[model samples]
Target chain A: MNIGSLLGAIGQGFIWGIMTLGIYITYKILNVSDLTVDGSFATGGAVFAVTALSNIHPTICLFIAMFVGGICGLVTGILHTKFKIPAILAGILTQLGLYSVNLRILGDKANISVAPVSTNITFLANVLNIPHTRAGMLLGIIISIMCILLLYFLLGTEFGASIRATGNNEKMIRALGVNTDNIKLFGIILSNMLIGLSGALLVQMNKYADVGMGKGAIVYGLASIVIGEVFFRRFSNFGIKLMSSVFGCIVFFIIRAFVISLGLKANDMQLLSATIVVIALAMPIFKENINIRKVGKINSLNEMKQVSSSDEIVKEKIEKREVTEVGGGNNA
Target chain B: MLKLKNIYKTFNSGTINEKRALDDINLVLNDGDFVTVIGGNGAGKSTLQNVISGTIMPDFGTVEINGINITKYPEHKRAKYIGRVFQDPMLGTASDMWIEENLALAIKRGENRSAFKWMIDNNNSLFFKEQVAKLGLGLEDRLKTKVKLLSGGQRQAITLLMSTLKKPDLLMLDEHTAALDPKTASLVLNLTDEIVKTSNITTLMITHNMRDALNYGNRLIMMDQGRIIFDVAGDEKKKLTVEDLLQKFNTTKDAPSDAMILG
Candidate 1:
């Protein structure tokens, strides 16, 4: 990739990093494979576009988007916890419902584009007088760092400890006097809030919000997390694990940029990303299976060698006994 | 103090699989009473504890702790007054968590968990180290180690420590040492004796081992077919022999099983 393209990829990666962080909470901390991101991400963008059109401050629109995204999470949480719906199904239900919600927020439009001279432009670009791409990159770095610190602090608290414990062992945490349902709800809400914020930032960066903006978003988030884990597997520090998501996202976007330059169609990228995630997730299991087969082969070979050696010893002993019998007969 | 009055539970009601787990069960435990429960399989020993701990609600009963009716309380809500360790060591702890983190959760068992308050601080870390040192397993320095890495015996010991850390109103041990080897089981039993004596906490322990049921607690009760057939305490309990108990069992029901006699 050229220098400019690489920089652009990094910038987009940072913005997506916020979404990855949200996925991390549900996927890692809450131990729930929440599929609400695709809907919540678009909800965020839709909220941002509608509010910005009404002349709300662009920065304030970010928080508004987050609030709306969190509502989307609340719906999923209630469905999963209270209505007894399976987690994945609950998330799918929300994602499905958000389709019409997003359209309504966009005034029945399929997409909405920010004018080139509109105030919907991000504060970093306006205040710093920098190029749009550079502003996004800087903003992403600043916001991601702030998010990392906040999460680090939050996870260290008593409530955060219970959330982690709930993810680790639901029964144990419940037995310890924690209402696991409440903790799960809080986790889902917080996760989607961050995802919503990421969506708002992306809408501002691309200067447009489309109804299908968040298609395949969950796979992207999972890929970022899986790739991040491969890099930070050895580190038990919570902060380092969170940072790995951003780094992974940056690498993922860089790879995408390079593949696009190689003449790959954008339509084919979804299949490619899904395949990458599947391979990454299955890597450890594959290694374990291979090791087990190797050990099994060696063990069987050893058993066969022992059986053959013992047979030879028994035959040699019988031969010696026969010779002794013949020699004794001659003495007689 | 704990009370279970008129407790009745029937599993698979009205079906061929229907079985009465607890039938008209009534139990009352005074403060600091350590009661050892002994019974064979399907004898309602575990069902009684489960009823008290809110794992399953009785079809008909009023469960009370210190005069407060908790029959309708959920398991997590009842946990404010109850502490439990399961037969399976894995059920008692979050294996992936650090030793200190687990202990921190235990220490706040009945307290409000604040969002902004730090779970582990320097002061609490030192306290946890001291508490772990008392286990005498050389685990004081390994506070950062995950609980999954510990042996079954070690995990049970930690679980025991956690259950009693907050001085819960009632402690329930459902065959806590049944999963450990004999040596580890005896060690854990001894530790249990020491902790109960030191803290004077009210406890209910269920076990199949007759000798253990006789040896450790202040009182002993035998259950058969969802009923407490025999209850003994004070000098009568202290002076009773294994032979006397077996003879009592022979008269009350069938002859004692070989496992019960050997135990």
Candidate 2:
């Protein structure tokens, strides 16, 4: 692909990276695959479009869109927590209902174009004397960093630890006196707010918000998260993990741009995104299976048994050593 | 102190496979009482603890802690006064959390968790390290280690510490060390005794091991088919032996299982 197109793809990737971060909150941290993004994403863009058209300041429009997205998440949360609906089903219900809600927000239109140079990204470019693509990328980087910092701070807080614990072990957290339902609601709301913000940014950059723009958005978000995780597997830092989602999205778009440049149809990109997620998800399992096959090829049964048992013994010895070293350190 | 008055629970009430888990049960625990419960499979031992802990609401009864009736309290709401360690080592802890984080959650039990406060401060970390050091497992320095990496015995010990960290009004352990090897089980059981004794917390621990039931606590109750068939405490419980418990089991409609005999 040409350098210009590659840069444009990277810019789009950063904008969508915000949405991927939103999905990461639900998908990775909360351990719930919330389908509400398909609906909330479109809702975000539509809210931003309608608000920006009213001569509202572009920055304020972004917050408005994010608030509207949180409302969408609240609906899903209520359906899941209060009504006792399954989380995935509740997300689906909200997503399906959002289609009509999005249409209503769009003034009963299928799409609205903000293609005029007065749109925020273009305005930013004009103000800064930079290209529109460059302005979009700059905005994406700024917002993504702010989001990462905010999440890192919040997740380190007491309530945030409870939220993470709720996702990890609902029964255990509940037993420890956390209201898991409330924590879940808060998580969903925070997740969708970021998603809505991403949607607004995407509309600003693309110059249009279509009711169908969020179709299969979950797959794209998952693809970004999965790809990012595959690349940054060794880092356990939460901030780095969050940044990886954005990085994953940028890489995803770069690959897509290159693939499109190879004369692939745009309609085929959804299939490609789904394929990327599947491969990333299965990569660890595939590695394990290959290791098992290698072990199976060992001609001696004693060596095979030793391979399995020796690992555990070695791990135990290492852990024992570490504990003693720490104890010794305290004594000295 | 805890009280269970006229507690009754039935599973699959109308079905052919209907089973009465707890029937017209009544239990009362005095302050500083540590009760060990033993029973055969499906003897409602777990059901009794579940009812007390609000895991399952009794059909007709009231659970009172310090004379405050909590019959309608949800499990999480009642967690403020009650601490529980489950049979499975994995169930009592969030496996992905650090040891210090788990202890932090434990310390915050029954208090409103504020989003503004940092969960792990240096003070609490120091306090936790000191508390863990008392376990004598060399885990005091490994505060940042995730719980999943710990052995079953270590996990149970950590869980025991977490359950008692806040010094709840009541502690309930449902076979907390049953999954460990004999040596580990004994270690955890001794730790349980030390923590309970030091805090003087009211506790109800369930175990399939008859010897442990007899050896650990000041009171022992044997259950059979949804009712407490025998209750002994104080000097009487202290004098009871495994043979006495076996003879008592023989008097029931069903004989003791090999596991109980081995114990």
Candidate 3:
């Protein structure tokens, strides 16, 4: 790939990498398929774009977008935990609701493009004396790296262990005196906050936010997690998993770029992403079956050992009997 | 002490499949009381334990632990005062977690703080090792091993240790040894008896083995349908035999199911 193309792909990958962290929290840590990601992404973009357009500081706008996204996640958590709705359906319901909320945040427009010179990227580029695209790329990398570090620290905290425990075994955690419902709410909110931040960053990078930007976002996140786990098998630690997810997102984008270079159509990208996720999830199951077959072979070996040992004992007993019979005959 | 007064629990309350799981259950357990519960299938043994542990809300009743009415407390809330062991070895502890990690969580049960850091003090580890060492299963040296690698009986033994570590006011055992082989089951049972006697904690255990019911506890309770049909304690419980239990089972209006009898 050309240098410019490579930089562009890497920049986009960084943004998705942050989003993948959010996805990892919900999908891997909480073990919940949170479909609210799509709408929450748009929600972040819309909130950030509108707020920034109104002369708010970009940082403030970013925080606002994250807060909005967290609220969306909270709603999903409440619906699932309190109302007893299925988790997947709860996510779908929230995603659908956010569609209209996002539109309202964007003044009913499907797209919001900031003035070219006044856009967040241009403002940063002018301040730093760099090209807007390069500035955007640098900004994406910094934000993604910061997110990964913060998440890594959080997951190591006592509350984080409880959250991980909640996903790993809710019953055990509950029996340990943790109110897992609260933990679920906390996890979902945190996940969507990261997702929203990713959207906010994406809009600044592209100089515009569109309602359709979040489509297939969940699939992208899942694909990144799967790819990261596959690539980084030795890092089973929680921190490593977080970092791998970020790397997975970056790798995914680079792969996409390569696919484009190979003359693949843009329409086929989603198809390829879905296929990758399916294959990645099936890897462990496939590995397990192979391991089971190996175990069967080892078990047969153990059986043989037992058989030989028993035969030796029997032979020893028979020899003793022969000795006793010879002694009795000699005495006679 | 723990008390249950006139507790009633019915499943599928208005439908044709409605079944009474617990009926007018009344019992009083003093401090350090170790009681073994025995019944055929659907005899409300587990249901009674669930009710006391706050896993299920009784349709009508009162439960008091140490003179505190906990009838309305949620399951997680009641966990502070009650420790439980399930029949499935995998249910009581996280299989993927290290043995010490699981113990750490249990040790901190009912504490308000989170247990994120693995920087357990040497003193704490020494204490834990002492507790685990009591099982005589060599688990003190295997504290870092993931619990999933342990055998069912070993896991159950570890779970028993973990549960008694906190010395909750009431300990509930729900057929905890039913899943093991005979040898392993006896091993776990021996550990259970030792832990209960040494801790002097009030405990209620459910077991399908009639002999185990007669042998383990100072008191033995037999349930039929949703209510206790017989409760024998002290010297009388020690003198009871499997034949005596079989006679008691026959006299109850609700016949014991085949699974309960065979089990």
The best candidate in terms of DockQ: 1
Worst 10 residues of 1 chain B by lDDT: B250-259
Query: lDDT (CA) for every model shown?
Result: 0.87, 0.90, 0.85
Q: What lDDT tens digits, residue by residue, belong to model 1 across residues A25-99?
A: 999999998899999999999899889878887778888999999999999999988897998999999999999
The DockQ value obtained for model 1 is 0.54
In candidate 2, how many Å is residue B56 off? 0.7
Task: Estimate, for each residue in A119-207, the C-alpha lDDT of model 3 and write its tens digit.
Answer: 55677799999987788878888888898878777765556667777888888778778898988989999999999999998999887
Give the residue spans of candidate 2 off by over 4 A: A116-119, A288-332
Instruction: Compute the lDDT of residue A270 as modeled in candidate 2.
Output: 97
DockQ of 3: 0.31
Q: What is the C-alpha RMSD of each candidate to the true structure, in Å?
A: 9.1, 5.9, 9.8
Clashing pairs for model 1 are none
After superposition, which runs of candidate 3 have C-alpha atoms over 4 Å from their true positions? A115-128, A283-332, B115-126, B254-263
Range of the 10 consecutive residues with the lowest summed lDDT in candidate 3 chain B: B112-121
- What does TM-score give for chain A of every model? 0.88, 0.86, 0.84
Q: Is the docking of candidate 1 incorrect, acceptable, medium or high quality?
A: medium
Encode model 1's per-residue lDDT on B164-240: one tens digit a residue.
88888998999998899989999999989898889998989998788888898888888877888888887888987
DockQ comparison, 1 vs 3, better candidate: 1
Candidate 3's displacement at residue A63, Å, is 1.0
